[model samples]
Target chain A: MNNDHNEFMWLDEHHEVSLDEIIQLSGLTHDELHRLVENGALIPNNPTDDSWRFNSHYLVSILTLSRLKHDFELESDSLALTLVFLERIRTLEVQLQRSQHTNSAPTIDE
Target chain B: MKFKDYYEILGVARTASNDEIKKAYRKLAHQYHPDVSKDPAGEEKFKEVAEAYSTLKDAEKRAAYDQLGKHASGQEFKPPPDWSSQQGFQEYTFDDIDLSDLFAGFAKGKGRTHQSGRDRPIPGQDYELSAQISLEDAFRGTTLDLGFTVPEYDIQGQLKSVPHAFKARIPKGVTNNQKMLLRGKGGKGFHGGHDGNLYLNISFVPHRLFRVIDNDLYIDLPLTPWEATLGTTIKVPTLEGAVNLKIPAGTSSGQKLRIAKRGMPKHNQEFGDLFAVTKIIVPTTLSDQERVLLQQLADASTFNPRHHFE
Candidate 1:
């Protein structure tokens, strides 16, 4: 839940970090990031123009891609497609829940 | 069961031309093909695709599969007493799996003899259910006691109460309409089949003061006219509790104050901003002395909100 929102706000209070911090943490090359963007494998958060401000979560994605590239040698498109498949699975799971009713059914006590 | 009707499966009228049938098949094949499509159910659809195409592509096979109609895949398949015994007889074997196996239970032919005493394991039916939660519970990631029922077969061999409870965790910033999966919680599998999955859709009860949109939270902060004209530091309630916010002097109603990273806790532990919109309230009744002071202040200040409209 959101109880941690106030607590987490101070995580990046200094705001002194740079792309170098992302590279150090995620261990992905600048060229690889640019390639992912060029191939449409990644749609930048800002669509109008390309900016290099990556959120911490985006760094995690880069980390995942790095592992995929190292371990499986998957192309950027293939990794992107895999992410799309995972998203689809999440969507189907959600749709199934909407079709099922947990509270609408009457309880025995009721 | 009777093989699926090739025509119906392809959604084409029997009277349609070969070109029409081919077009329909091409479109459907593109959608259900394993190589090109992303449907998880594509494998099951592959069999159907092959069946329809084989039957429709050949003139002789098309005539035969059409004559068989619902019985194209039967077991007790007794051809019209003199079927093969007649003048022209042709038996076409197109599929690796026995066509009769597909039609055994469907048509009046041999009725399900192969399935005799066979305890087939029917995979459990997938089920979905939603849980509506409170904002605080969503924030704190509390467990919800969700209750539901299923039919339980017992020694008596009749439908019985199979009430069950599951404890579900509400993740931080659990948005409304989002789903959480609880595996193997749906209808029980038949004949020792794998149990189905249970999905939990997230929902939230409306809060008295806060309105959530995605990760952002919005709130209306009421301010006194005096506070709007001559601002002061005020205590505002946030999800994390209350914080003192400094209001700028000469602040006007409809001004927005943002408290950064105080909205919702996201997956990466990031938080959005909470925006507060100010609404200046005017006193309906005033004493003579209060009215005289306000009149003096109004005369001194040359501010008119409606000047832009004019």
Candidate 2:
């Protein structure tokens, strides 16, 4: 029955995560990271910077990709396509939710 | 600990070939993988599938497991006195494997010995949980008190879930369906390993007065027919507070008015716009004097709403 209150940390859309952090956290190799970037599956925070930077969304993407690579034995080439489809599916689902919420409201006479 | 039938868990025959077992595991893993699947119980199911596969995929482990044949699933069973001294059992360890108490108990001492050589530290598994907040909370940013159980090992090397309490901050400008990651706040690490991260899949509770689309907010502004034709200024509700909106004269129902920089906040102090959609409400019951006046106005009016149909 320990009632210790832990410290709070805020992460927003603007959080910039470094590439080394992604590698360490996700257990992905440097070659695999390069392949994902080459295939356009991932985008760095800045294109010209010597060290790569990533946004928070890339954290979720890397986790999903690593699992897919291990479980399905998928290569980065195929992963690129899968990432595209996953993004599309996520966008559509969000759009669907928004429309459903909007439609439930009272309509006006046209 | 209760014995779990690995073959039954993977939906494979006990005599199934390696390829067949692998195929079944792959399909089930895809369906129950916590990263991809939306099922609430997916993580637990995936853990079971993975544990089963880890044992069944290895030839030595499979043969050793088969030696304990025909025990009913979930039946309480203990290994023989000399089980650890068996040929394949001695070399087997739980170094990088996350096993249930049943398997962990059997491999406890052996796992520690095998790990003593390499001393490789394995990070803890990451955890995900969903949180809901009010749209206003998302707008203004707020703190949430969360209570949940996280798994840890006892002094006896037995795994158990311990209750934990923490406060997490929901940052401002977070849209619905956004995810935020809290680093090193998940399950406890082992052997000086780093703790795993916690991912918060955020969702906003639907508001009674407003509807959110992307970062924009929308609301139905009801007005009388005269107000729609002869517009006036009226107070409108925004996330911050109330603001007066000037409706242009001759505004039509279903017309939308945008209030810039008054919607949900975004990065760099940017904001999406709020839209107010007009809805003209008519009185259901009118007095005789009002009905007469309406009739006169309608009769005198030359506007024909159905001119195209005519």
Candidate 3:
């Protein structure tokens, strides 16, 4: 058994997804991917260079955008904004949940 | 075997145009997409709609399916001898397979005879499953026995869910909300395409004794009223075990005492500090002698806790 195949790596800068790999996995065209970057919906790990790889964290965002475009039949140009907004909404939802948990703690005032 | 009506699932008439069918499928999919919908059954509904659209969209497959004629959904029926399907003599009990698989097999059988089995390399589908672990498990690396179903098109061209079970090793000290990528642990790829990856969104089960903030942990430390005033050393529970923590004099309820490097462990032997918040517990009943001593002290002490109110 290859242990690496079952091993899990933390989502970090080291887990790099190349441009070609993302397009293949996500079924996003080369042009659609470029437009997402142009709209700032998809940001590369290093904006200044590589321009061809993204941090593994963006996989969910990219896949979600592609799914939305395919299902709703929306063009890539129109979906770039929707993707950005959806990402923001998801982030805010997580933040809200964390905050509620923190606030619900028992504060015993002496 | 139960029969499934693809057109009915998509809410389109048998004679509906391709454009109309596409529109219905899009609307249903948009409403039930797991990531988009809040409905608990959205995932299942979306899959059904997608299965229906897969054949309905293809001209040849639709024609093949239309020949089966309309039957009430979920009615027990058997496929005609001619329609036992064209992928060899293998039989399918709908319980083991699905209506979609049968139709998919029809297409695959057609492709085989027409194209001489020229198969395209189809990439395996990726999957995500959320995993919950205890704080103790996070402190010490643990193994997770995960069981999940992966949707795949088998060698026989039957679209089915392959049950996949494996023990995943979760590294120690993984923070909450972190996603772990398991390479080649997802559905097996078709042809020469690479196997899919699995993403495990790791979360810690709530601990009754401790609340985790990032790598650090906060614990409610209950102390006797005298202990709060006179300072004392008490054993507090940590992720490892009980450890002696010092409670300074004049410690008040809600005040946090930091125990350096005693919380969660991190990489390279680094550790997070623990915070023990003080809570004063006063006894309701006292002995006669204790009451007398307390009354005497009450008479002597002039400390006013409400001085700030003035």
Candidate 4:
């Protein structure tokens, strides 16, 4: 009956770590966190607040963006475009997951 | 020092109409104006255009210049002895424009003679970018690995943006609004012309400790009431770092301590002095006994701080 808790549970199942714990653990500055959110590489539970709450899944993505900018010398605008394109890839993977769940039948082998 | 073809510089034919010549000159002048054009050779090209127009637009000078023939490529293009004394040519003076070496006759090849072709590259246009450094860095020279993007025309004739990284040495005692000219590192000239220069304007970041005037430095040194009254050798911060400073006894709160030759380095003749103004900080929250001691000290002292205001 309670879909709110169900959604949180679903998010937990999808991501290995919760958002609050990740926000506390992340070492990035407020501006850096906001930059990640603005670039769409990070999505926060509280959009109004400046925080890039990253789990294990988002951690790798943030690292990739950092490496591109600091190491590979990609400009902020170019890195933002790369993040947007990468997010699309992540969305497609999620769509495939949903389609597989819908098509699978219950097994009698259980 | 070969003679430059003024007509070729303006991209006009010798028989160009006066109106056509005027129109071309105007267009070329606007494009090659030093203030407007980013081109490295804009200044030189603009001068060349103006010189061409000055000679060709005149009937007599054009006739005389035409007589020189191919020898005008620089060797035998000397003006007639009485060319300047000629009648009815007051409007066109050689002083306004840079006449050829043969015309001016200063030497065979003297003064600001220009070069042509790939052999003589004009210095490219200097590119400018700004950066900020801390006051400490400005006081004690610092170097930065600055990254800048320069728009360069590649071999394909396309304007491509190239990122250049270079170490820029910032000299010590450089003040705000001061410019450092780095020669031979500007835009590439046409047909392999000489490169241009780079100009760096210094800007100092804010400092928590001190404020700098042109060459002088000012800082507020906090002193206790007793130290101001009794005087002491206290540790003070200078642009060169901290130094032991002697404070005279019976010093007022606004008394200035001068440290000679300790401010900014001498740019022209002599270094400036550093002035440390003493600011006596009184404790707001005092113990009963401590308050009694301060009241006793104030009662005993004959110093009146506001005597000058009256």
Error of 1 at B150 (Å): 2.0
| Residue B72 displacement (Å), model 4 | 52
**What is model 4's DockQ versus the real complex?**
0.01
DockQ of each: 0.04, 0.21, 0.34, 0.01
Question: How would you encode candidate 4's per-residue C-alpha lDDT over B146-235 as one tens digit per residue?
Answer: 766554444533334466677877666566445454545555554465555555656667678776665667678799888887888988
Highest lDDT among the candidates is held by which one? 3
User: lDDT by residue for model 4 over A1-110, one digit each (tens)?
Assistant: 11122111111112343344333223334566567677766676556654323433454344345534532335655755766665676557556644532323221110
Please, what are the lDDT tens digits per residue for candidate 3 over residues B1-310?
A: 5678999999989999999999999899879988789999999999899889988998877876776667899887766667545434244444555676566556444554444655655456678899999999988889999888776666665557679999998877677777777878887776676888887888889899988876778888899988999989999888778888777787878776778777787644688878787778888999999899889989999999999999
Give per-residue CA lDDT, model 3, range A1-110, as digits (tens). Answer: 11132356565433667788678767889998888888888888767786577876666677778877876778756978987887788678667755643544343321
TM-score of chain A of each: 0.46, 0.70, 0.73, 0.49
- TM-score per prediction, in order, is 0.47, 0.81, 0.81, 0.43
Error of 2 at B206 (Å): 1.0
Which CAPRI tier for candidate 1? incorrect
Query: Candidate 2, which segments miss by more than 4 Å at Cα?
Result: A1-14, A94-110, B30-47, B60-70, B76-111, B115-118, B267-272, B306-310
Total backbone collisions for each predicted model: 6, 0, 0, 10
RMSD of 3: 4.6
Q: What 10-residue stretch in candidate 2 chain A is worst by lDDT?
A: A1-10
Model 1 steric clash pairs: A1-B138, A1-B139, A1-B172, A2-B139, B2-B106, B76-B110
Docking class of 3: acceptable
lDDT string, candidate 1, B1-310, tens digits: 2355678777888777788877887787668765447998985685586567666766755665666545443433433444322313322222232442223112211211235523455455445566778777776677778777654333422223456676765567566555444556766654566665565667788788776655666677789888877878888888889888777777666666777877776656688667676778888999999999999998998878789897
Best candidate per DockQ, number?
3
Against the correct fold, how does model 2 do in TM-score? 0.81
